[model samples]
Target: MRLNFSIKTKIILMNMGILIPIIIFIYVTITNNLYSNVIKSNIDLLTKESYNTQVYISNYIEKDKGVDIETNFVHKAPLINTYLSKKLNYRIQIYDKNGDIMTDSVANRVTLFDKDITNAIKGNKAYVVKKIDGNIYILFSSPIYLKDATLGCVRYIYTLDIEEKFINNMFIIMGILAFMSILISWLLSKLLSEKIVGPIKKLKTVSQKVTKGEYDNRIKIRSGDEIEDLAETFNVMSESIKDYVESLKEERQKQKKFLDNVTHEFKTPLTAIIGYSEIIPKLKKQSDIDESLVFVKEEGIRLLKLVEELLDLSKLGKSEFKIDRKKNNLKEIIEEVLIIINPRLKKYEIEIIKDLCDIEVLIDKDKIKQVILNVLDNAIKYSECTNINIKLQIENEKVILNIIDDGIGIAKENISRLFEPTYRVNNLNSINNNGNGLGLCICKEIMKKQNGDIKIKSNLQEGTSIEIIFEGN
Candidate 1:
């Protein structure tokens, strides 16, 4: 298992990890330095006292005019030790040339034979600081010289009771202050952690709600930082998901309606074919049989046409259904569409007016031809107009092809649904019309796959204008 810590706890731990060691190191260093300075000050004082006492005893022996200076100093050792110890307010000791203690100011006390005393007897001055019976003191020793002759040594033992007490009090005070500083830092860390983690907690809660399909809920962080930017991004993602789901639902409904319309369209022609076949066998007259047979053939053709258009509509926009877009003369393609649709135009007694422009564009040649044919067919069958105009031109760096009719135009409401599958204006269902309502739908899909678009504009009884736009090469 892994351990998980909250932001607040981590922040507190991090502060402690940084602060505790520093506090300890500073405290130890300060305490050691204080002790060293105090010890050094006492050593200096005791050394000075030892030097002065050595000079006083040396002068006193010199004035005695005795050839045995060692004997004279030994006899005067008690007096010198007493006088100097009283003047300096420190304990003192006198040693002979043999490193033996001759006299001490502290009477009947145990003689301390230490390294400092031995160094003084060897004609060198030295001092040492040590603890004895829980009391700290500095022992300083100096060699006493008389006219370059070896005499003896004087030693001083200075107590550091006051300095030790002061150091101890300072250590205690610093420790308490350190504890207080740590406490303050911990509290501040808690507050700071809360300030940082508060918004994050809100973000987590809102995210959980979004996971449960609550797309309307949004974060409201105003920190003016990256966290706020993240909240904005999260809101955008939620909105996108909501929109995608709604589009899917709408698409599913459209699919259901498309299926129902396909079934109805197929059933109508099939029902007519079946009915005409049943009547043909019962009819006795030769004309009647031929007429019935003709009806069957017509319905069969209509049904076949519907199936082919449905197949074309289904393949558009699918990955496997590729559109081979290449540079082609759009004006020539429009002429080809007019030629193919010429027979139907003449049968309807409709006149064609052309305003063609020479321009090349990137598009699938056959698909553009089909889209053009489908639009012209719709115009011939439903527009009820005398003349259909075909125009191609380059406008604003785009190749635009327009097939407009001055006929009984569609309503504004119906124009919007013109590209929808099986959507008809005024429900124009008849044999001559022969529309399964997939022509415009197929045209729209083809234009989209070709990286172009088709749009329609119409007003009831006025006219219909169909615009096809493609990027010019």
Candidate 2:
């Protein structure tokens, strides 16, 4: 299996790396200091004893004649060898002026780096550590000066066997303690990492669940630190994402219903146009042929109108749709829409009453007229009245065009979402059923593109009123 280097494991390894070296260095430093102190104390004792022997021989020669007195003193120094050896644990040697070992207090074995007699006679004290018969020892040599004449030299050789054994036992014990400390540090680091990394692991798992669309999963941590802050932020993000997803699903359902309705709306006119065209060609009677031809023409026109409106809606949805705004009179655009609706107004005996003004504004002429035509078309389509009032009034630096019709008005419940894409009034009379349900929606978008707005108010059976607003230059 592949080993995952988790945060817990990393923390443990880092702790051990820092802790083990510190423990080992401390143990080694204390042991070395203790060993050095013991070595220094032993060397001091040996030097004091050696100094006393040198002073005794020098005084004895000063009292008696020279070489004979030194010879007798060298022999006398060895007589106390058993007492010095047992007391100080050192080997002593006395050399004559000729570099000969005249008397030795040690056994047949000697431990020295080189012959110390020649160097000592040249008036230099010498000392060295050497390995003799696989045993480590130190040799210290000092010259005895009698006035200006050299008498002899004294040498002391000693071993640190006892101190070496003591420090070795310290090494073994310290190694055991260091290992124990490392193990304890690793365990403590493990426990600490669990407390630190445990909440983070839970956050990961909950985030994974949220990724898989289970947005309800929340990271519940009580650490009361930055980790808790992270969990709280994560919970908020999940809720936001869930709300966004739900809104998208609702929008998707709306688009689906719109498509179904559009297919049916388009198919109805296409089927009628196709059927009437075939019938007009086959009919023998002139009235029947004329009636069939008129039906074919009307249905074909409606199908074309629906396709054009749908195309306009799509282009408005795009960010790339550009408009050319020029200075124009609002009355002219209204006049254009009024001309389009004149034939229908005459057919329904609906009078067109205009209360407009010469309001000049910056607007796209053709696009603005399309919005006016659509709103006027709805006023004509969904209502029946003897007169349709088209009035324009300026208020608060805005040009407001009000289109009022006394007809079957919309229920208050449906007025709020009247401009939603592909939305239609379900309870419309049979004569107004030819709508594609997106005319008012396109009207709203067109007005918005020109930096304007549309508002509508109506009551059941009373009339509907629509206001188109534009910023006055």
Candidate 3:
């Protein structure tokens, strides 16, 4: 079976694996050196004390002249035992130069059966020994000379169980310390790994969200380090991508609107041209030449207007139409629009009510004129009422113009899309008579260029109000 581990777990394990060996190695090195030094010091102290005790006993025995060695040492055995017992925490023994144990702290007298006694008799200073009974001890011996004649030797024995116990205890403590150190190291590794990997996991999740097209998703990490910097960069990148996508969407919308408007405008003019051209020859026998010429001129003019609007819309779509702005009287501009549309207004029986305000605004004069003409023309074509009210007012440092009429009003559903090119309102009477749907769209664009906006309010069979706002100078 394959092993599966999360990234966090794997990081923890890897860190532990690297750090545990180093910790263990360091602990072992330190503990081994410390324990070795302690044990060696204790052993050396015990050996030195045993050697000194043997030397002291031999010198005292040799000091007596013409005395039986056994009797003299036997009498002093109690004093030696008292001294050795207080100084060394172990059983001590004394042996003669002939390898015969003379006195023992644990026994009155003893025979030299241990190898330590045999070795001591051969003038060994100090040596460690292990008896058959598994007792470990250190023995030291020294010779006693009486006027160049070897009389006897003295031996001392010290048990080593205390040192053994000390070493065993140290081992146990080291084992416990090692285990605790490993545990603490593991825990610390886990914590540090989590701190490092937690943000990475969040980043992974955010990346997946972005991959799924959720460009607005962001990662929040404030580590004050490289990880935090990485998250900040990711957020910036996501925002940039989102902005680019929105810009692309807007461009596509503009392109679609431009194509639809151009198609609609061309279709009407082309149809009129073909229809009039087809009817011209047939009507020649019944119509005067001048009337036919006028009909042709009207169609030609209509086609020319369509071409002009299409070209203007295309230039605007390219973002190449620069506005030539100057301070101008908005009232004078409206008056000029009214004069231009006078023939249409009279023909359509549309009444004009102008509520002009003296407001000067910075705008492109020709562009503002086109905006006014398009909106008023649309109103005159759709309004069933004879009176069309044009209101101008200044408020909040802005010039506001409202063109209202009792027109075949726009439906509620179409009101929102009124400024969308080629999106005509679904009223046949208005659609049949109104200008191309691009009128409102063009007005909206022109108003936007002038640092202004256009808005509409309408209900079916009521009136439609078109409002324009311009920046006041």
Candidate 4:
């Protein structure tokens, strides 16, 4: 079973676990030892005093041959006890050999030291510790011997009130000290726990802020420990997250720009198709009517192509839009494209110089053909080039197809944005041209999906070169 205790709780529990037992053990040990030593020392003192009194009685009995031992003890007991009480501070008692109490300084009080009395009757010295009426005492008993016979026994009763009171006062002081120790331990433990847990808490707060979309928030801790290292790691993670968020924002803005461009591009072709179709029936002269119908047909075809490109782009975004990969001839693909655009090239007085390599490459044949067609079309549209050079070569384990043209080249500024969706170069010479600009964007997307890429390099008034790079066979 796992107990999810907070750091502070765990710290306090652990500290107390160690400290409380130690404090109690020390207090009990010291108190017990002191009490035991005091009792032991007091018993020793009483034993010696009782022995001296017994000797005095023995000598007194020997000197007076006719005196009654009990009567003599009775007479001398008051003075002896008075002197002992004043000098040594203990009560004295005398017991006869038969265990009869002859004298008790406590004034006929019942004896609680029966075990001590029994031992004294056996002619053996004995002592016992006893508590009576909430007060402690030690009773020491010693036998009196006269000529190989037990005459009487001496009993000493010492009150332990002052010793006990002293021990209790010491106990109170120890308890107070223990409490102070616990307080200090608790304060230090808390301070240390906070120091250790502080950085983690800051990290949690900052991480939550980042979770709530505050990517800029970070923890700054300077404890110079593992937690500081953790904080530094957290800060790095925050920076990475911030960078990722920034990239996402830029991508979103680009997508917005693409959508706006799409709107404009679609609008232009639809408008042209609509306008030309509306004007065709109103023309009377045969030449004017033919011209208008031709324009209408051209715009209609352009619109259809634009729609197909948009559909293809959308399908490629889905998981199910897979292409047929087969071994295809690059030479044949180029020849086919050239044949398709042969008439248009001838009409523009453009000559194509093809240096084709007959290499079999694994590719989506149709998609690659589309890319070539788009690039060639762009070259024909914007450039008044009389010559276009096409070359396919294997280099550095890759197939590179280069198309060079001497045409109205793209400006340096427009080269970067050329392959973006619906982004067209604004040609000052031909602003009236109806180019939707989705062609190159579609080509680029198709190449990317096929694990290939397209790159264009252009110089204004000089020429443009388009390189299509693909994995070599």
For candidate 4, write residues 216-329 as lDDT tens digits: 777889888988998888889888988988899998887776665564434434544565566667778999878666656655676676666665565546655556778999
**Residue 40 C-alpha lDDT in model 4:** 82
State every prediction's TM-score relative to the real structure.
0.41, 0.38, 0.38, 0.40
| Backbone clashes counted, model 1 | 0
Structure candidate 1, residue pairs in collision: none
> Which window of 10 residues has the lowest lDDT sum in candidate 1?
427-436
**Which candidate ranks first by lDDT, i.e. highest?**
1
Candidate 1 local lDDT, 333-379, one digit each (tens): 87765544444565668898989878888888866766776677677
Candidate 3: C-alpha lDDT: 0.70
> Which tens-of-lDDT digit does each residue in 177-259 have in candidate 2?
88888888888888878777988789878988998999988788989988899999999999999999999999789777666
Angstrom error of the Cα, residue 146, model 2: value is 99
Q: Which candidate tops TM-score?
A: 1
Q: Worst 10-residue stretch by lDDT in candidate 3?
A: 264-273
Better of 2 and 4 by lDDT: 4
Q: Report the Cα lDDT for candidate 1.
A: 0.78
